[model samples]
Each structure stands twice: as structure tokens, then as C-alpha cells.
Target: MKVQSSRDFKLQREVDYGTPEQNKAVKQIVADIKQEGDAALFRYTEKFDGAQVDSSNIRVTEEELKAAYNHVEDSFVAAIRAAADNIRAFHARQKRNSWMDLQPDGTILGQIIRPLQRVGVYVPGGKASYPSSVLMNVIPAQIAGVPEIVMVTPPATGGKEGIDPYILVAAAEAGVNEIYRVGGAQAVAALAFGTESIAPVDKICGPGNIYVALAKREVYGAVDIDSIAGPSEIVVLADDTAEPAYVAADLLSQAEHDEMASAILVTPSQRLADAVAAEVERQLRELPREAIARASVDNYGAIIVVESLEEGISVVNRLAPEHLEIVAQDPMALTGAVQNAGAIFLGPYSSEPVGDYFAGPNHIIPTNGTARFSSPVDVDDFIKKSSLIYYSKEALLRDGSTIIELARREGLEAHARAVEIRLENEAKGGVERGE
Candidate 1:
């Protein structure tokens, strides 16, 4: 790990997200899936994932769903069930009901909240299996009352037939049965635009690789997407009181996620910075994914030494990391000062992994400085709101002139005429009927 001053340190990897060739390839794949549907999806799944997928076995069968339990241990099932309970409980609090308010003038003003009819959650497969992602994505949509929740993952788990048993078990525990054995850009397209086998969804949520992220970007308008997620990021805003071992361990936790992932420690104490830099080097050797973690720490990781804790906070807000940890004597004191972070863990105990898996909050968070404007996946992502406006005869007549004047001022005669016609008819009816 490199230690540098906050003033001189600069991030260079943000310039190129993915190669131009990768972006161009994803565009063609998305286009092919949209046009050719099932054929293209099957071809891509076979080509990329090295698995043969067809209409007959694309969707996971009930038998497969049941047998997935046989492959995993009872301990795994118990853990998943416990995590699902917490995830469901947390998201349930976010559930909303349609509301309307009747005004004194007999006008009804309110908003109607309706869950999406269907949604798709893309879970990555192959070497890594994210059963945690299953719970994170599906549980919210379920709480929002999404009727049809379809889950798509790669065909093979560790280059073998069928998806990971843990993934299947998690989906089953999360109360999702419509599982599909497909992944990557092709699966995203299948969810965006309906195929003969898979129906289209109203929205797509979850994280994936660069290709999957690019695919989600491509299909934004056709269907709603979560966000264009970037590499995983973490910023530990620490002080002299922070633990060097804990800070180094937490930083490495995210660094091992991918070679492009970034982990930074910003602190005012040069002594703590030196300690953490040494601890990171010592801990990096022990990780199973040492090569990937080493690459990440060597390229993107840093220990930024600042003059004061306030200066460190400014650097954190500028980076706007996906995960932030405030490990100091008074961690909560600085909580309100943090303007941008996907998730904040205060104190040494609230490790980043606490929120990633067991914690109730969604692990799928905004990345690449998008925390400034965007938010994490929640019930709001699965639900849409329609503004409700009911104008009574008395209310319309009272506000009609004002509306007409405002509409006409904008040179929209049609808009003004729409209000004028209604008001004129009301006046004429009152005169003729003697009401």
C-alpha cells in the first residue's frame, strides 16, 4: 500500500471504465438479444458461460429448486433463513400504501403507490456465487408487492451445469421461484425486452461485472434499471484512536472483491497512517485472493495523510466512496458532516462486511461517485407513484381563471382551452338549469 499526502494523491483509473472494444461488444450483444431473442440469448450463454441453454431447461424446474436444498448443509439454510428474516423485516418498513386526502372544497389530492407488475434481478454466477445478492434484490421487490420476480444467473456455477445450489436455495428462501439459468448482457436484454421464453420486466436491479453494467446502461429507456455501478470503493476516515489492524483488514475486505476495487485510508495522524500502511502489507499476504488484492492495493489503494480530521472528511466527500467507515474517538460526531457515502459504518466494530451480508441494508449500492445524487436499491425502486388530483366543480371554478391565464402566458392555447371548455360548460349549465 502507498502512503501519500492528501494534496498530492490523484486517482487515474476513473478515466477508462471499460475498454472501447468491450463496450462495442456489449452493444452488439444487447442489440442481438433484443432482435433475435431466445436464439441470441442461448448462443451468448453457450459462448461466454460454456453452458448449453435452451427453452426446455432455461428456467429452473421445481425439482431443481427442491433438490438445491440437498446440495447445501442445514447450517447454510439456517443462515440464509435468518438473513432473509432481517432483510425482509428491514424492507417491510419501507412498504407504502396509496393515500388520498379530501380537501374542504371537495377536491381530492393524493398520490397512489403501485408496485411493478414484474421485475428482474441479475445475479452473477461462475467462480463467484452471490446468494446474498439474491436476498438483497428479491426481498425489496417482494415487500413492494411485485407479483412476478424473475431471477437470472449464469448457467454454470464454477463451470459446471446448473447454477449454484446456495443461490437456488437463497432464491427459494426469499420466496422467488421464477429462476432462469442465464446471465450477462444477454440476460439483461431478455429481461428488458421479452423473449419467447422470458417475459419482460418493468425494472431490473442488482450488480454485475463490467459487461453486465454496460448492458444495464444500454437498456435504460426500454425498462427502468438500478444504476450504472462502477468498481467497489471504500474510504476509512480514521484518526489516531483508530485500530490499525481493523482498518487494514476492512480495507482488504473490499480490495479482494476485484482488481479494480479501491481502498483508501484518510487520517490526520501520520503515525496511524504508517501503522495502517504496514498492516495492509502484512495482511495482503494472508488473503486467498492475494494477487487480486495486491493489484488493487498497489494500483488504487492508498493511505492519505491529512493535516486535520476535517481535511480528511473533505477528501472523503470528494471521493464519495461506496462504503465509508468512521473509526475515531468520536465517530458519530462526524456522521452529519459526511455528505456522500453509499453506506457508513461508525466505530471499529461496524465493519463494511456487516452491511454487505448479515446486515438488513441492501449491499447493492451506488458507486463511482454516484452517491452524490443516486441512492441504494430500495422499495422505491420497485414501486412507482402516480400523482392524484381531483377537481370539484366549486374548486375548478374558483381556480379556473388563474389556470387559464397561466396556461395562456406560456402560449399553449390547447392547455388553456382544455380548462376553459370545462369552466364554460359549468357556467352555461348553471344558467340553463337554474342551479
Candidate 2:
């Protein structure tokens, strides 16, 4: 890790928009799946995931869900159940009900909030299994009252034909019974367009590699999708009172996620900066994913020495990191100054991983400066709102002329006439009735 003055450093990471060739490939795959349905789905599953899947074995059976329990330890099941409870409890608080307001004028206005009919969660596999992601994605939709929550993961893990038992257990624990053995862009297409074995979903959530991201972008209009996520990031805003080891270890937790992940530190104390820079170096060597972490730290990581804590806050706002830790003496006091972080961890003990695993907050947050405008997955993500408008005769008569004027001003004669015709009809009816 390199230590530099805050004035001299600027964060820069090239956004990975898939190459033209890759984009073309993804479009073609989505088109094929949309056209041929199960035939293209099975063919691509074999070509990409090396799994000879068909309609017979495309979906995971109840027997497999039960057998997955035998492969996983009792401790994992217990821990997952506890985590699920916490997640459920937290999201349950975010549930919303349809509301209507009735006025004295006999007009009613409100919003009708309802859960999506179905949702698809894509879990990455082939070398990695994120059971945490399963809970993060599924629980919120469940809380929103989605009737169907389906999961799709790569058919193979570590070159084997079976899914990771942990992933299966997590899905079962999360109350998702529809599990499919398919992945890549084709999986996304199947989720969006439906195949013989799978049903189309109203929205797709979860993260994957570049190809998956491209496919999600391609199918976005047909079905809603979670954000196209970028690499993981962490920004630690610490002070002289912060421990160097804790700061360094927290930074490396994100760096070890992948080669593109960024870990940064911003502080006012020169002594603490020097200590953390050294500590990061010492800890980087011990991480199992050393090469990947080393590459991230060498390329994207930085420790900036600022003149004051206020200046450090300004820098943090500019970066808008996905995960932010404030390890100052008064971490909570600094939180109001932070305007742009996906998740904020205060004090040394509230490490980033706590939010990632056991914490109730959703870990699938916006990345690549998207925290500036977006939010993490939640109950709201799985629900849609429709504006409810009930205009009584008195209310419409009172507001009709104003609406006609506004619509006519915009050169929309049809809109204005629609309101005008109603008013005219009412007036003629009143005259005929001797009102």
C-alpha cells in the first residue's frame, strides 16, 4: 500500500462495460433462449457449465433439497437458521400496506403497493458459492410477499456436476423451492422469457460475472433487474484513536474479494496513516487470496493523509464507497457528515463483514460510486406501487377547467378535450334535469 497526501491522490477504476464481442455474444444467447426456449437453454447449459441438463433434471427435486442437509454440518444449518431469522425480522419492519385517504369532497387518493408475482435470484458458482447472497436476495422478496422466488446458479461447482450443498441448504432455508441448474446469459434469458421447465419472473436480483451483468442489462426492459453491480469497495475513515491492525484488517477484507476490489483509508493523523500502511502490508501476506488482494492493493488501494477530520469527510463523500468504516474516537458523531455510503460501520468493532453476514442490513449494495444515487436491495425492491386516483363528480367539476388549461397549454388537444367533454356532459345533464 502506498501512503500519499490527500491533495495528490484521485480514485480511478475503469468501468467494465463488456467488450463488443462479449456484448454481441450475450445478445445472441438471450435471443436464442427467447426463441428456442428449453432447447437453447439446455444446449447452452452444456456448452458453458458442462452440465448435460434437460427438462427431466433441470429443476432440483425435494429429495435433493433434503439430501443437501446431510452434506452440510448441523452447525451450519443452525447458524443459517439464526441468520435467516434475523434477516426476516429486519425486513419485516420494512413491509408497507396499501393506504387510501378520503376527503370531505368525496375524493379518494392513495397508493396501492403489491409484491411482484415472481422473482429470480442468480447466485454465482463454478468456483465460488455465496450462501449469504442467497439469504440477502431471497429474504427481502419473501418479506415483500412475493408468491414465487426462484434461484438459478451455475450447474457446476469446482468442475463437478452438482450444485454446492451449502447453496442448496441456504435456498431451502430461505424458503425458495424452485432451484434451477443453469447459469450465464442463458439463465438470465430463461428467467426473463420463460422456458418449458422455468417460469418467467417479474424481476431478477443478485450478482454475477461480466457476462451475466451484460445479460441483465439486455433483458432489463422485459423484466426488472437489480443494479449491474461493480467490484466491491471499502473506505475506512479513521483517526489517531483508531487501531492500525483493525483498520488494516477491515480494508483487506474487501480487497481479498477480487483483483478489482478497492480498499482505502483517509485520516488526519500522519502517525496513524504510517502505522496502518505498514499493518496492511503485514496482513496482506497472510491472506489466502494473497495474489488477488495484492493486485487490488497495489493498483487501487491508497492511504491518504489529510489535514483535518472535516477534510477527510469531504473526501469520503466524493468517493461514495460501497462500504465505509469510521474508526474514530467518536464514530457516530461523524455519521451525519457522511452523505454517500452504501453501508456505514461505526467504531472498530462494527467491521464491514458484520454487515455482510450476520447483520440485518442487505449486503448487496450499490458499488462503483452508485451509492450516490441508488440503494441496497430491500423489501421495496420486490414491490411495485400504483397510484390510486378516485375523482368524485364534485372534485372533477372543480378541477376540470384548470386541467384543461394545463393540457391545452402543452398542445395536447385530446387531453384537454377529454376533460372538456365530461364537463359538457355534466352541464347538459344538469340543464335537462332542471337543476
Candidate 3:
């Protein structure tokens, strides 16, 4: 890893709007599925995932769900169950109820919160399984009372015609039974537009590759979607008291995620910066994903020597990283100064991975610099709120002219007339008294 002054370094990763060819390909695939449903779905599943999927075995059977347990150890099941409980307990606090306020004027105004009828969670397969993602995506929806939650993953894993058993086990544990053996843009389309075997969903959530991100963007208007996530990132804001080995290890945790992923360190101590730079190089060689981590550290990773810890905080706010760790002598004191991190880990013991798997917070967070404007996936993501307005005659009579004046000023005659007609009818006693 390279060490530089805070003034000299700026973290930059090109936003990946897919190539024209890839975008055109995604558009065509989405159109084909929207027009030709299951036929196009199966065609692309075979073309991209190399699996022959059809209505006969399109959805995972209960037999497969139960048999998945045989492939995973009892300890693994116990651990997942514990993690699920923590996730549920955490999201349960975020549940909201429909509320109404009744005024003396007999007007009723409130907001009705209702969960989406159905949701689809896409789990990527063929390379590695992310069982943690299953819990992260499904538990919040479940807490919000989503009735139907479905999952879609690539049909084949490592060139074989079966899904990863651990992923199946995670789904079962997370209380999702509607698992589909399809993937890529076609699966995204199937989730947006109903097919013979798969039903349409109100929203889709999960992480995927470039094609999946583009497909989510394509189907966004037809149905809601989670953000188009970028690569993983971790920024460690440490001081002279911080541990070099721990800092280096935490940075590499995200670095190993992808070559495009970024790991950065900002601190005031030049001695600590030198120590962590050396420690990161020593630890990078031992990671199993060495080539990926090496490229990430070489290309995107940096250690910056700042003038002071306050300047370090300013740099972190500018970066707005996906994950942040403050390994200072007084880590909690620095938290109020942070304004842009997706998840903040304070103190040495609160490592990034603790929040990734076992902690109650959602692991699916905004990547790149989007944390400045967006938030993590939560119960709010699965529910929709409708504004409830029950205007009594007295209330409408008092406010009607004001509303008409504003609407007419905006050049919306129909909107003004809608209110005017009500007022005119009430004046003539055409409307019934309590109707």
C-alpha cells in the first residue's frame, strides 16, 4: 500500500454505467422476458448459467429445502439461527403503526403504512455463497409483514446443476420458501413481470454483478428496487494508539471482496501510518484471495498522513465510505463528527465484520459515496405509506379558496376546479349534510 499526504490523495472509482453493448443486451433481455415470459427466462438461464430450467423444476421443492440441512453442519445451523434472532430483534424496533389525528373540526388526517404484498431477493451463485445476505434482505421484510418473499439464484454452481446447499439452508432459516432456480437479467425481469412459474414482486433487493445492476435499473419503474450497489469499501480512521495489525487486517477484509473495492486509512501519526502500510503488505500475502486483494491495495487502497485528527475526519466525510472504523483512544468521541459513513464501528473490539454478520443492523448498505444521501435496507424499504385525508365540510370550506388560489397560480385549472366544484356544491346545499 502507498502512503501519501492528505492533500495529495483523492479516492476515485469510475462509475460503471455499463458499455453500450451490455446496456443494449440488458434492454433486449428485459424486453424479451416482458413479452415472452417463461420461454425467454429459461433460454437465458441456460445461456448464462448453463442450466436447463423449466416449469417442471423451476422452483426449489420442499425436499430440496430439507435435504439442504444434511449438507450443512449442526453448528452452522445454530450460528445462523442465532444471527437471525439478532437481526429480527433489531428490525422489530423499527416497525411502525398506522396513525390518525382527529381534530376538533372533525377532520381526519393520517398516514397508512402497509407492507408490499411480495418481494424478491436475488442471491448470487456460481462463485461463492453469501448466506449472510439472505438474512440481511429477508428479515427486515418479514418484520415489516411482507406476506410473500421469494428468492432467485443462478441454477448452476461450479458448472453443476444444483444450488449451493448453504444458500438453501440460509433461505429456509430466513423463512423464505419460494426459491427459484434462475438468474441474470431474465430473473430480474421475471420478478418485475409475472411468468408462468414465478409471480411478479413489488420490489427487488440484493447484490449482483454489472448485468444484474443494469437489469435492476431497467425494471425500476415497473417495480421498485434497491440501489445499484457498487463494490465494498472500508475506511479506517485511526490514531497513534491504534493497533497496526488490527487496522491492516480490517482494511484487507474489504480489499479481499473485489479488485474494485477500496480500503483507506487516514490518521495524524506518521509513525502509525508507516507501521500500517508495512502491516498491510505483510497481511496481503497471507489472504487466500491474494491476487484480488493485492490488486485492490495496489490500485485503490491508500494510507494518508494528515495534519491532525480533525483534518482526518474532514477527509472521511468527503470520501463517505461504506464502512468506517475509528480505532482511536477515544473512538466514541469522534462519532458525532462523522456525517457520511454507512456503518460506523468504534473502538478496537467493534470490527467491521461484527456488524456484517452477527450484529442487528442490516449489512446491505449504500456503497460508493451514496451514503451521503441514502440509507441501509430496513423495514422502511419493504413498506409503502399512503397519505390519508378525510376533509370534513367545515375544514374544506375554510381552506377551499386558499387551495384554489394556489392551484390556479400554478396554471392547473382542473386542480383548482376540483376544489371549486366542491365549494359551489356545498354553497347550494346540493351535497348531503353528513354524506
Which is better, 1 or 3, measured by lDDT? 3
Estimate TM-scores for all models.
0.96, 0.97, 0.97
Which residue segments of model 3 deviate by more than 4 Å? 158-161, 428-435
Candidate 1 backbone overlaps, count: 0
Q: Runs in model 2 with CA error above 4 Å?
A: 158-161, 431-435
Model 1, residue 192: distance off in Å is 0.9
lDDT, candidate 1, 135-196, per-residue tens: 99999999999999999988886355468899999999999999899999899999999899
Candidate 1 residue pairs that clash: none
Error of 1 at 101 (Å): 1.8
Candidate 1 positional error at 84, Å: 1.1
The per-model lDDT (C-alpha) reads 0.90, 0.93, 0.93
**Model 1 TM-score on a 0 to 1 scale:** 0.96
Q: 355-399 in candidate 2: lDDT tens per residue? A: 898879899999999999999889999999999999999999999
lDDT of 3 by residue, 144-187 (tens): 99999999998874246388888999999999999999988899
Clashes of each: 0, 0, 0
Q: Clashes in model 2: which pairs? A: none
